[model samples]
Each structure stands twice: as structure tokens, then as C-alpha cells.
Target: MERKALFFLDECRTVISTSIKKVLAKVGSKPVMRVNIGFSSIYVILAINAWTGEVVVSLAKRPNSESVKYFLRYFKRRVGSGRVYMVMDNYSPHKTKGTLEVCRRKGIHPVFTPPYSPELNMAEAVFKSLKNYMSNKIFYTIEDVKNCIKQFFKENKYRFNLNAITYLGLDKIEV
Candidate 1:
């Protein structure tokens, strides 16, 4: 599973957007660039099923223990009928009492990646795509970001290429 954070702005503002080519102007003419001032950051948690590459996402106002717990409940429901060997990063919220309790009840045994090793959590790759997709893009409101994200998740449903997860191998994840 992977988790990421995104900020959204209510107003659109960009003095100079992304440009593919350099301005061929006098040396004294420097271009000024600007982007909309972001207002709130939405904490998003993403979980992917390795076998099917199915992803589920949850958004919250804060990235705290309560939110993690909420996401865990969502994950448990998504996981359906079995125990899960959920690989995760060592985020503090992952170790919260509420989250642990949910895991215990839901039969989700979270295996933490070794400290300082963010790469071990495969969700980073998915989020990287999300970032690139949103980079330099303008959104008029938070709903715009939400709608875009919804579309992204929909189009990419079960679409993650999991060749990097060779150790476990494909079709070996579901229990």
C-alpha cells in the first residue's frame, strides 16, 4: 500500500505556467513564473493489492492516527475475506494504537519496511505517476483535484505494472 499527500487551491492563479522551450529574448528580459497559492493539503492514503494490482484510496483532512485508522478500516473491507501481509513504511501513524487495533481485529499483519528504506514500499512508484500527472496543472478548486484524482484512479484501476515485485512473483499475493 502507498500513501501520499496533495495540496489543493480554491482559486486559479498562474503568472507563468510550464514551458517546454526557453524564451529567446534579450539577456535583461527574465521571465517571471507563478502558481496558485495552495490553501489546504488533503491527506491521501492509497493501498494496492499486489496480485491484481487493484488500488484503493482514502482522503482525510489530517494525516494522523485517526485518519490512518479510518483508512485501515477501508482497507480491511477492501481486502475482504483473509489475513493480509500488508507491507508498509514506518510512518508514525502506522504505529498508532487505533491502527494497530484495527489490524489486529481485521487480521492485517503489517510488515514494516526497514527504517530509511522508502523504496521498499512499492506505492512510491504509483504516487510518482500521480505527481507527474498533476505537475504544473492548474485546478480552479479542490473539487477539481478530487475529480482529476478520481479519473486517474478509475483509468488506472488494476493497471499497475508490478514487474518490480519479482521476489513475491505475480499471482502469488492473494491469500
Candidate 2:
């Protein structure tokens, strides 16, 4: 059997406003955070190569079966011809018939993490890092948020370690 490349896939929603976090302020004085008044969100769909730390990201207005399938095709093109094993959460779009058909046609396999077990998916860590980077930072428009996300991934591309044995503790489990 040919060795398959491993990747962890996930989606994160980023808003144009900053995330609320505890801040150090003078007693009796509330910390002030200026935010955009209206709601604007973008979904970031990504796949992280478990061995190479290579990241592929796509932005969408919302995460749906069509968007997920599009990202899968994009990811397949980026990775070239190879059997891929993708670990992901059980998101509704990920299991849709269209998305599965795309996977089947592209030689991609989806392995879902157990319910309520986000930690099992290494992609969650990438999302957490992205959220932390975006926290306490105000963006006036969705484009600003999108640029920030793109910059974050470009700057920190080498920082991600998606090794399953290290992150999922697979090495400790006696097979």
C-alpha cells in the first residue's frame, strides 16, 4: 500500500470585532475596547500537513457543503497526486453527500474525531493560535480581518507542529 499523507482539517469563524479577554486595568475603571458595531463573519477552512506543517487556507462567507467541497478540490490541487488521510471534526458539511463524493473522487479520506473531542484534531490548535492572534485586535472591515488571518498564517507557517504522535498522544498508546 502506498503511504498516505496525513492532514488535519477544520473551520474557524472570524468576526470583524475583537474577542473579549481579561485585561489589566486600573481598579474601578473598565477596560475599553472599540469594536465594529455590525456583525460580519468569515469562515476559514484549513488543512495542515501533519508531517510538513504546510497549511492551506480558504475563506468563505459561511461553511457549507459547497464551500467544503471547493476547499477539498483546492487542497487536492495544492498537494498534487497523493492518497491523503484527513482528520477532521464531524461538521455537517464535511459529511454531506457532495463533499464525500468529492473526497472519493479525489482520493482523499476523512477520519472524524470522536464527538466532544476537539483536542483529538490537531487543526483545532491552529485555530486556537489564530484566535489568540486576533484577540484584542479591532478590525474595521472584514477585509482587514481577512488580511490579518492571511498574514498570521504566512508569518507563523513554520510554527505549527501537526505531528499526531506528539499532539494526539498516539505514541503512548500500545497498539
Candidate 3:
């Protein structure tokens, strides 16, 4: 049998600035946090290897079909030639004809999670970890957020155990 590469795919939007409603501080001293009222944000499209925990990330201005296609191309290039099975959510852009076409051209098979079942996608855990890593931190600009994301992944490339998190028993399957 031909080798198959399995990946969990997802996208998330990171805002440039976030406001924290609560914080731990000394008594009688109010904690001040810089918050950007502007809605400037960037979308991150990410894919993680189900067996190896390898990751591919892309920053996009918008979370649309075009961005999905672009990420698919980028993923293909990074992963090289292989039979890829990408498990993703049922986002509208993920099901668009253009995105499907790109997946077909790149030899990527999309396996979507059941409707409204984001928990089934292991990528959600990665995103949650990323959010926690960035929590209580201030980002001055979209670039700052982008740089932070890159640094986070770079410093913690093996932070996640895909086999354990996904409960997919990836290690038991022959690649």
C-alpha cells in the first residue's frame, strides 16, 4: 500500500489587541493593560501531521476560499509528494468548489468533521494551546501577533503529542 500522510487542519483569527476583564494584582492597586480598540486581525491557517506533530502555518488577511487554496498549495510544497488525508472542519470556505479544486490538484483528501463538532478536530487543541500561550499578552500590531505565532511554533515545535491528543492511534497504523 502507498504511504499516506494524515494531517489535521484548521484556521483561527488572532486580533492585534485584546482586552482582559480580570487580572491578578496587588490589593488597592489597579492593573492597567493596553488595549487596542481597533479590530485589526489576521487569520492563521494551520495543519499538523497526525503522526509526527509536524506543522505548517500560514498567515492570511482573510479567512476565505482563496486563502484556503493558498494554504493547500503551501502545504503541498512543504510536505512534498504524497497521499495526504487532511481532516478539517466544515467551514464554508473548506467546502467551496475552488478549495476542492485546489485540494484535488494537490492530491489532498479532505475529511471534514461532523457538523458543529469542532471537538473532533485535533487542531482545536493546538489552537487552544496557542491562545493560552498568547493570553494576557499585549500585541501592538498585527505584525507583532504574527511574529509571536511564529516564535511560539518555533520554540515549541514538539509541544503537542498528536497521537495522544487526537486519540486516533496514529502510531498503530502503518504509514
Stretch of 10 with least lDDT, candidate 1? 6-15
By summed lDDT, which 10 consecutive residues of candidate 2 come out lowest?
157-166
Q: How far in Å is the alpha carbon of 162 misplaced in model 3?
A: 2.4
**lDDT of every predicted structure (CA atoms):** 0.62, 0.87, 0.83
> Can you tell me which runs of candidate 1 are displaced by over 4 Å?
1-34, 167-175
> For model 1, what is the error of residue 50's alpha carbon versus the real structure, in angstroms, after optimal superposition?
2.2
The model with the greater lDDT, 1 or 2, is 2
- lDDT by residue (tens digit), candidate 1, 1-175: 6532211101111111221334466788886544556664555577766545566687677777887788878877765756677777777888888878888998878777778876555566667676666666566666777766667777777357653345245446877
Task: Rank the models by TM-score, top first.
Answer: 2, 3, 1
Question: What's the lDDT of the predicted structure labeled candidate 2?
Answer: 0.87
Q: Quote model 3's TM-score.
A: 0.85
- Which regions of candidate 3 are displaced past 4 Å? 1-3, 19-30, 164-175
The reply for model 2, stretches above 4 Å from the true place, is 1-3, 23-31, 173-175
- Please report the candidate that would top TM-score against the real structure: 2
lDDT of 3 by residue, 104-148 (tens): 989999998889987677778788888877777888788888998
Question: Any idea what lDDT model 3 has?
Answer: 0.83
